[model samples]
Target: MTEKNAYQQAGVDIKAGEQAVELMKDAVADTYTPNVLDGIGGFGAAYALGSNYKNPVLVSGADGVGTKLLLAIAADKHNTIGQDLVAMVANDILAQGAKPAFILDYLAVDKMRPEVVAEIVTGVAKAAKASGMALIGGESAELPGLYAKNHYDLAAFAVGVAEREQLLDPNNVAVGDVLIGLPSSGIHSNGYSLVRQVLGITTSERFKDLPIAMQETLLTPTKLYAQAVWPLVEQGFVQSMAHITGGGLTENLPRAYAKTLSAKINWGSWPILPIFNELQAAGDLSLEDMLLTFNNGLGMVLVVKSEDTQKVISQLSQTNQAAYIIGEMVNGQESGVVFEGDAPW
Candidate 1:
């Protein structure tokens, strides 16, 4: 009997990795945009944002869906996580008033399952298309000993472009500006680690009894603001926008407020999603945790002048967007989001 070398015995298969890469070549190619200068496998991805817009400011952000991938694995649902990955990065930059131009992804797994890989990548492609960005490229590794079977980690990079004068900066925010909140697709990939810990439940179990519409809500693709808010921004109806993510409104909203101003969120004004109520009930999570962790339904926020608020809300509604006047900027020494009344939870 011949003894195998240490590398082979440990299950590190360079040939298999190469084969996996070869197998995904075509699907990868489908994601490329016109600005993509080269194919994958280079030391780095080369994208030319080249002379596309006048005085273009490059906005770039990188992020992962975090332990939300654990939920995807537990549910044996690979499709939606990819969209979550794109949202994590794209939305962050979109908060700065830029439009995503191209995206790159990174996938690391114990072993590659072609179907699962395809499902995840397909989500990325679909999301990129929805956001008007091209899924330029990505890397997938088959590391046998590093992860559990059916367990994988996903991340992405999104680059956007905005004119110098068009960028939304916190400095422009002022007192009396109104905050319009957009509804979030349930738990859009943040605070999941805490959620899982507190719920003491599996993703499949947590999602099982939900109505079809609600389950779909969990898997619903992220709401891309590039199209919804960009026109308003270009038309001068917006002061600044906040992309509600990891830190929730308790943290993110204040960042967009001036140091001398704060936001007062009217609890009755915004619609809270059912999933959030379920989480709070299941975990007995305090209001503080709820406000600081979960999105509590609001996703993206647009801070606009009081006079422009009604027009902006009308336009968003006409576009079939669920927009609400959730709060107003007020003069205060501290910058933070203050809930004005009791939440139904």
Candidate 2:
């Protein structure tokens, strides 16, 4: 009798793993710039920073797609979430005024399926290219005992570089600075647990009958701000920026402010997407809770001198990014952020 391999009996398919690598190789290579020094299938990815700076600071961020992955798996849509992974980390690094250089992903699944893995990596490669970040390498693990079949999770590490003098510092944010709001794609990758609950996603009937538009809204990928905002950062146009993720504007905007300063957001100044309005009505959520949980409609908040607000807005408009003067920084009381006028909800 032939001896059986314990690893195969445990359900890890080595052949499937090899197939995944072969399928993803071309997609990953497409994201490479001259900086990437090694091909795929290496034990470690290699990149040459080259001699490009007076003072270089490597900025890195690690983040996952959060519960948004659940929805992706539920909907059988695997592609866009990889972009969500890249956007979450790349945008965070961009907050520090860094240009993303490369990214690595971590994908763990209950079972290895080459097609599914390839689809996921294809999306990662797409977003990496779009953000000008090289998709240098990543890991795909198959753990049969840990997750149920068809269940998986994704996380990513993004590395960026900035000149030491050019790194954004919230300490530089001061009173009288204007706050510019950048439009979000939709709900993005945050508050989906509440989103699922609010929308009654667990019920099969509810899931099947979800409004077509609403379904699309819920799955919209996070916006990648690096390509759009990096030029502004390089030009010293942005003093500070907050990427609105899980915390919404109420929490995120303040991250870019000095302690002595508070953000005064004009609640009705920008358009609140219909999806947010729907969530509020469905969940009966108060405006405060909504602002604290979801992004509402703005995905990013940029702090700039009052005099330069128009210039910044105009430049963003040229790039087809709709931006609005959503608020201003003022002497603080106790809260870091304060809203003005009636709540949009």
Candidate 3:
């Protein structure tokens, strides 16, 4: 007769997973705000709701780290990727003019590595706290046979709330509204699949020398915009906002607005980040392709009336966020974003 062990017998060490959670206890605690009801190691996490706003509408978004995972694997730096995971969802919901309430993370790994797991979770907690969100619940799974030893995946879900009147929509955008652009933290999480496909398997040192600040820019985590845009939204200064993600500016701006109005962007108004230039040179990617594919340099954008534009910029500046007056809304047959000259790509 043979004695059987737990999943630990099959290389998935439950004890090691538990130990990993124990190690992350302190780091996770550092992210807690008044709304977070418990620590990270619970089956369920709780939050206080219904007491903060009138007719609080809950907005939620779930997103993963995307192909940027390859960079983490290549550099062996897992912490910042977790922040990217949180940023993806939180920033998306923030575009709707909602204040983040709580966050939940999901981590799946081929094997249990206490240190690496802790580092990744620490990053998630950091972003959540930075956005004034509570890290309430999450799941960690260890599957030895499902993945390569060095492979893992991370996903995050964030919930936000706003009063019905506080919500922003493009319907409020008039032809005179100005387009405000927010700077991105480099390549962000999109187009990496294309990046790796173009660059292939290069050494980290060589990856660092690819014309731009590859190491710093590539490792740049996603921008969390909740704290920066909340005040503007609360003051009713922002008419509508867009979070540039998978589709670049052209695709995302039409989301919260009606198609009858079009946006004309001034290419020279914003400075294109060096990383984008390098990608253009390296891949010889056309201007149109680049504009449709990446955020270029702008991450989040706020649309405001001409009268309120200065106030919006001043408010954003006070929050340490630089806002660019990229262009203005215009009349067009189509209801999408249009480029007047060249996109600042």
Candidate 4:
């Protein structure tokens, strides 16, 4: 038998890391914009920011896929989660009305597996291209002690540029502005820890045993919103926007507007995704917990003037993006998100 090298014996494989990089090279190249100045092997990636805006503001967001990674890894599915990683950050900056320009990812694993890493990065590259961002650079860390074998975590930092005056402002989000919701692709990337508990997915084998379609649905990558909402931002059609994430609508909506204003949701205006309903039944969870955690159905919400509501919804439909008017901003004393009617649970 061939003897293991010193580093290999220590659980760090340099050859494997190099191979992973080689495998991901093509995918990474595919996402490069004309502004990209360096290749995958460079010490640092570079991009030339052409003078595009009169007064540019840089918007950045950092996030991980959270426990959603657990489900993907358990199922040995690597392709789509990378997109989830990208979406978490991309959508966040989009909430600020910024156009995503580039992304840097960090992947850490217990032991480097070239094929798996490549698969993950290919998804990332695809998502970056879709979101109009360059996959500029990233790191693949093999930390033996920090993670379990065949286990890994992925995070991304996205940087975007927006004109100073065009950035979405909470101060400008006035009462009477209508709320428009964009549907989600499954739960996106949050509340998965609860999902696993609710579904009783206690082991990799159990997760793997689920019907293939269900597995795919559960692991569906987060939807990129730059294509859907950027046009509205460019046209000054939206006063503010919220990317419903870990905190769901109850928490995230308030961040989009001034504290004096409250979002009043008209329950049952939009149909909740079946997956959330299934989870609620299985876990016997209260409506409050569901809203406090999962997005229930909507992924992104826009604050628009009532006059522009139909125009905004019509434009989204033209792009094959389905949006619904779910609520409106109110001048009432209630703070944050205020529920008006009971959800048709």
Candidate 5:
């Protein structure tokens, strides 16, 4: 056998990798814009900034799907995980009022499976397009001993640009500004480490007895808010924004505004989803811990002037998803977050 064949014998198949690229070509092409100067097979992706901004400030973010990948693999679900990978990072940059331009993803697998790779990349392309980004390039590798059989890890890096003069600043958030809560679809993409444990979601079991809605949500991808919130940012309707992730509202909301002020939250203002309540009861977890770990029904929070509250909510309503006036910004050097009403559960 030739050297190329020998490499395949060791489990890394060059021909299979080439096949995977071929399958994903059409999907990747769909996300390209005039700025995507080069296609796949390049050492680096070249995207032109062009004359889009008077002064362009680049914002970049990187994140993985976290332990959520374990559940997807266990259930043999590979599609939506790519979107989750994109959202985990894309939402972070979007929070700072950046317009997404391009993204690159990385996939590492135990074996060379072209079909699986194509499936994942297709999902990535779909999400990137929704976020108005060009999926310029990506990498997929096969390592024999590194990952377990049929297991892989996924991550992505995103870059966006905002006008230097228009970048959102927490300092711009006034004391009377209200917080608008964007409802999440179940857990989105965080706290799976606890969710998997409390619910007995093991590698061998796929929640057959669980309610169909809960079962489907376990692998649901994170929602990309670019479509709904970008217009608000462009119109200067927002002061600051927060993307709820690992630390939930407890940690994320504080970053949306100045450290000198605190957020006065009306706990019963919005309805917490049943998923959170179920997880809380199943794990016997306290409200504090639950709030810290999960998104608690709100995935993204925006700080807007009290006057713009209705306008923002009205605009967001067109998306057909509910947005709520859950809280307000206030003067308090004491704590970053202060709860007023009781949990609606």
Candidate 6:
């Protein structure tokens, strides 16, 4: 075996990894539920499955921040990206009518910085606490060549649980079910590749040059819907749900529809966010592309019976979440989303 005298010269820093662990350990501990059996720095984290669930089904989702990380990097914002990470998976599990139980993150960087790593973990901890999930453990890796200095990537895996009978099944979604649109907190971690193209800015550009509102909107963290949605699920008002992520309404909404049903989204039913409008005009993007790309405004769509629409909206309002009756599921020619009226774009 060849002896390598200096691992630091090769760009991997063992001490930095240890420092990161020390910095984030307390924040990680803050997300622990009574079920969490072990803390951070364990070779493997453990969480006891409580006996509360008789027929519990574990719902798991894995997601990354995508090009949105570039925006975060550009803005020198590390905190909100963790919320985006949790929202991406927690909302997915919520769509299935599950309660988020625990989350673990994977953060990889070319060089490790304790403060940066701790800032990211703090964001994750904030989100995990919001979702009522334990931040059991995670890995922070320093891969010198894979990423550039000051550049890092985040990916997270979340596990949720639902009683078998409580799981939201798309098959339960039927014709005439109304689609309720829950307004997003800006972009919510998707469609940024086009956003950057429209703005024509590099990752290093300070967002300060843009209008303050636009900058804030772009950096707003993804909203966690669990607190609002869980109640509706328990009340048996929500039939199904779709987390509008990468595919926007064009792709995601269909995931919750029965084969016999197609979603008819009413154009102009909800207000489209200004950031989306800015992107469309700047990019000269067509209505088709806009609908297929950005979320426009709606973040998560709840499919409910027509009679239950007002109830759901009213409940969401209590949480300071404004919702709209954006559309309905219909027995149409095909099983997909069909936008009604002229394109708002």
Which parts of model 3 are misplaced by more than 4 Å? 1-6, 202-213, 343-345
On TM-score, the stronger of 1 and 5 is 5
Name the Cα RMSD for model 1: 3.0
Instruction: Give the 10-residue window scoring lowest on summed lDDT in candidate 2.
Output: 203-212
Angstrom error of the Cα, residue 259, model 3: value is 0.6
Model 4 residue pairs with clashes: none
Q: For model 5, what is the alpha-carbon lDDT of residue 123?
A: 93
Best of the candidates, lDDT:
4
lDDT of 4 by residue, 114-193 (tens): 99999999999999999999999999999999987789989898899999999999999887899999999889999998
Tell me how far the alpha carbon of residue 299 in candidate 2 is from the true structure, in angstroms, after superposition. 0.5
Off by over 4 Å in 4: 1-4
Candidate 3 lDDT trough over 10 residues, lowest sum? 201-210
Tens-digit lDDT string for candidate 2 (170-255): 99998899999999999889998899898889843565578777777788998988777888999999999999998888788878
Cα-based lDDT at residue 151, candidate 1: 86
lDDT of 3 by residue, 120-185 (tens): 998888888888887787888997888776888888888988998888877898887899999998
TM-score of each: 0.89, 0.96, 0.93, 0.96, 0.96, 0.94
lDDT of 1 by residue, 189-290 (tens): 888888776656454666565566655555655666676777788788888888888778988887776777889888878778877888888888888888
* Model 5 agreement with the true structure over 126-203: per-residue lDDT tens digits: 999989999998899999999999999999999999998778898998788999999887798899989988998765
Badly placed stretches (over 4 Å) of model 5 are 1-4, 206-212
- The TM-score measured for candidate 3 stands at 0.93
Give the candidates in order of lDDT, highest first: 4, 2, 5, 6, 3, 1
**Candidate 6 at 94: error in angstroms?**
0.8
Which parts of model 6 have CA positions greater than 4 angstroms off?
Answer: 1-5, 206-209
For candidate 6, list the clashing residue pairs, or say none. none
Give the Å error, residue 105, model 6: 0.2
lDDT of 5: 0.88
